[model samples]
Target: MSTADDLKKLRLKAQIGITTVLGLVSIYILLTQPDNSSLQKWAIGTLGIIVGYWLK
Candidate 1:
């Protein structure tokens, strides 16, 4: 494969890894502290950004 392909794959992997880790963190926080609306909103917002970047 080309260098471009490798770079693309690396970017995709990074994005997926970030999304997974953040998602897990959010789940833990939600389970442990359900009243923290700010953190939850932040998590959702970051995920939205990631999703938007992924879509773009």
Candidate 2:
């Protein structure tokens, strides 16, 4: 209804979209790799979490 409300809605939509995309990408990456390589994926996932937090 108002400008602030509109901006908040947009931000929420963007966050949801980005989170969904990230989840899919992570799943794809993990599935494509070997079991032995999971540790590396966990490390990268940790770093991604940290970076994503900082970004927010």
Candidate 3:
């Protein structure tokens, strides 16, 4: 009902959406075992970045 509430809702939505998508990416990478290490690194790095950003 207020600007602060709106902002909180927006932040929550963005966080959830980004996290879910990145999580799926990590799952996909794990399921489809890429031969190149870079893909695996990307999956790990992305999830790490998300966790680091949100948890902080």
The lDDT per prediction is: 0.78, 0.72, 0.86
RMSD of each: 2.8, 4.6, 2.1
lDDT for model 1: 0.78
> In model 1, what is the error at residue 35, expressed in angstroms?
1.9
Tens-digit per-residue lDDT, 1-56, candidate 3 = 57998999999999899899988988699678766678888888888998898889
lDDT of 2 at 56: 77
Candidate 3 global Cα RMSD:
2.1
lDDT of 2 by residue, 1-56 (tens): 57998999999898777777776666676767777687547746855885686597
Candidate order, TM-score descending: 3, 1, 2
Kindly give the stretch of ten consecutive residues in candidate 1 with the minimal lDDT sum. Answer: 27-36
Off by over 4 Å in 1: 44-56
Residue pairs with backbone atoms closer than 3 Å in model 1 (clashes): none
Q: Which of the two candidates, 1 or 2, achieves a greater lDDT against the reference?
A: 1
lDDT of each residue in 1-56, candidate 1, tens digit only? 56998999999899789888887887676667667589877766766876787788
Per-candidate TM-score against the hidden true structure: 0.65, 0.62, 0.74
How does candidate 2 score on lDDT?
A: 0.72
